[model samples]
Target: MDGLFTYNPAMVKAALGTHMVTGYAEDTFITIEEISQGTTSKTGCDGETVRSVDPNTRFSVKLTLQMGSPTHKYLLNRYNRDKKDGNGSFPILINDLTGKEKFSAINAWVTKLPTNTKGKEGQNKEWTLETGQADFQIE
Candidate 1:
């Protein structure tokens, strides 16, 4: 479909920073890395290559604290749209930080945005942190 879509890693990072559930702040300097995308195909009757309807994008971010607490890690994912639907939304997943471990548990948190809101001409739109659970285990 022909629609505007944007993914600001900065904004995603900011969202994670403001997330108190992680018990960390933006100053913590979390490192985010992209993992992989569509690289496989389904079984086909012919040798023709089949494209994935929704390509996947994965991210891994690490957060270390000065305290003796374990380091925190998060995994984020974004899937591309297969078909254009006015009611379709983007999906976001989050993994909380635990002990010195490098990655959080899978499916720690997940949410979706049905539609994006528009702001005044030059002003930026604000994102609301009104979903998912919030708690800190890394001290």
Candidate 2:
């Protein structure tokens, strides 16, 4: 138990929650726990000069999911089903593993699903789901 020579252990956190998409199935469950990063618009933004900053700008979040999972399948199903019906915002919650009473979001919707399917055999099929919100909560 020599602290000075041991590497620090990782701080792991599971992301599991539900969000309303197209009202196809109220409270669609995102059942995956091997999350790596939960990020926001701050992930790649620079501080503005004091004189040019706009305080009214809204920040968004992007959630990435591996392909072939139930969550991915459900979202893909929704996307294929309702994408032609016009896009709209819905509530979302990126919560703890229990899928209840955790983080909360209002008026959010996926803005992009960049298909960067490259490699000789169509590898790298991960999906990036970007959503925007006017309000967010984590408790």
lDDT minimum window of 10 residues, candidate 1: 123-132
Evaluate residue 133 in candidate 1 and report its C-alpha lDDT on the 0 to 100 scale: 24
Per-model lDDT: 0.32, 0.39
Best by lDDT: 2
Give the per-residue lDDT of model 2 (tens digit) for 33-133.
Answer: 21223332342246643333333324444444433335555555545544777544455555443322244445444455647565554232333343433
Compose the digit string of candidate 1's lDDT tens values, residues 1-139: 8866553323432233333323333353444444445365676778777766434344443443322222222212221221233322222334333222132322222223223334553222112212222222232
Lowest lDDT 10-residue stretch of candidate 2: 7-16
TM-score of each prediction: 0.24, 0.42
Q: After superposition, how far is residue 123 of candidate 1 from its true place, in Å?
A: 41
lDDT of 2 at 19: 34
Model 1's lDDT to the true fold?
A: 0.32
Candidate 2: residue pairs that collide: none
